[model samples]
Target: MKILIIEDEIALQQSIAESLEKENFLVETAADYHSAVEKVFVYQYDCILLDIMLPKGSGLDILEELKKVGKAENVIIISAKDSLDDKLKGLELGADDYLTKPFHLAELNARVKAVLRRKNQQGKNTIELRNTVLDLNERQFFVNDKNIPLNRKEFDILNYFLLNKKRLVTKTGLAEHVWGDNSDQADNLDFVYYQIKNLRKKLQEAQAEIEIESTYGIGYKLIEK
Candidate 1:
């Protein structure tokens, strides 16, 4: 999953990003309000970790922007303020959960997963399409109740495809989703092709009901076989 961390505190921001990355989450950061607004408008994320106080603007306004466009789904507000009004107001504006500052990274991670489950996965840990099941918690894939082993990148790529089934997924988007910002430094995305090839072979060998169709010069689309 991808997460946006909107925080002005440099140390805390880096800490949060590192912790989330260890959990295999593609994380992006916005140190100030302007940057945060830009990312929120430009990309889609599984969840957003929002800080109430920003450098130039209140984070509440960001939430308002999200709600206005109906892209507001999984948002967990993290702030230093513990006022009841802030908590109530944030929830009223559609935040999934609120965490006060001085929180453990483990707790934040747990909250992010919970929100992704409740909002994106419909309160379930697994996402099912036809006979294929991807377990979000266990990080496992199953076909016809048989577990299919997958490497880390393979699992991330497959998870990205399943999340965007049948949609036009560009190679750039796939790279960013699986490898985060570091993918931009790669000399080429030839590695992506090889990984998908391996994943496809495994699925075919297992007689999976889904196929990842190529879009020629574009990327791929996961469809029913």
Candidate 2:
């Protein structure tokens, strides 16, 4: 999954980004409101960690903008303020959950997983599509009740494809979603093709019901076989 951390505190923001990245999530960060706004308008994320107090812009305003654009990214407000009004306002503005500062990182991680489960897997621990079942908690994949071994990148790629099944996924988007911001430094996306090829082989060997189709000059799409 991809996550954006909109926080003005550089240390806290980096910590959160590192934590999420360790959990195999692609993480991007914005230190101020303008950068956050720019990121939201330019890219898509599975979830957003929004800090209400920002430099030069309020997180509430960002939330309002998200609502206006109809971006359905699940947001969790992390603010130092513990007031009910703040919580209520954030919730009313479409935040999935709220976490106060001085909270444990473990708690934050759990909440993030819970929100993702609710948003992507309908509050279930597993994601099922066709004959494939992904155990979100365990990070395991099963096809026809048999476990399919996949490397980390392969799993990430497959999970991304499942999350956006049938949608046209660009090579750049796929790269960024898995490799994070570092993908931008690459001169070519030929590595993406290699990953896809390996993943396809695994799926074919397992007789999986889904397939990843190339869109000529565009990217790839996940479809049922």
Candidate 3:
């Protein structure tokens, strides 16, 4: 999953980013209100961790802007304010959940998973595509009731495609999502080609009939047969 973290505290922001990255999530961060607004306007995210207090503006304003524009991005408010009015207001403004400051990273992680489940996965940990089932918690794939082995990158690629099924994902988008922003400076996208090829082979070998169609000059799309 891809996440946008809007927090002003540099230390806490980096910590949250690192922890989410370790869970195999594509994480992007914004340190202040304007940057956060720009990112939300430009890119899509599965979820957003928004801080109630920001350097230039309040996170509530950001949430209000999103709602004004009809953006359905799932938002979880992370704030130091524990007032009932604050919580109610956030929820009223379409915040999916709220977590106070000084909470455990593990707890935050669990809440993230919960919100993702409720928002994207239909409150389930497993995602069922046409011929495959993906166990998000275990990072495993099953086909025809049998487990299929996939390397980390292969799994990441497959999971990303599955999550974005039927969407035309550009090569640049895939590279940035899977390999991070540093991929933009690479000399070649051979790594992406290799990973997609490997993932295709693994699924085919597992008797899964899914296919990824290359868009020639564009990117790829997972097509269900």
lDDT of 2 by residue, 1-225 (tens): 899999999999988888888889999999999999999989999999999889998999999889888874599888874455776787887898777775556556756775786686566777788999988788899999999999899998888777667767778667755774457579999989999999999999999999999999878989998
Lowest summed lDDT over 10 consecutive residues: which window, candidate 1? 175-184
Assess each prediction's global lDDT (C-alpha) against the native: 0.84, 0.83, 0.81
Residue pairs in candidate 2 whose N, alpha carbon or C atoms collide under 3 angstroms: none
TM-score of each: 0.54, 0.54, 0.54
Residue range 125-221, candidate 1, lDDT tens digits? 7889898999989999999999999999999888877766776676766775477446668999998999999999999999999999999997888
Off by over 4 Å in 2: 1-55, 58-73, 76-120
The parts of candidate 1 lying over 4 Å away from their true place are 123-225
Candidate 3 C-alpha RMSD relative to the actual structure: 13.3
Instruction: State the lDDT of candidate 3 residue by residue for 106-203, as single tens digits.
Output: 55775677567657555678878777898888999899879998888788788777766776776766775567445757998989999999888888
Model 3's number of clashes is 0
List clashing residue pairs in candidate 1: none
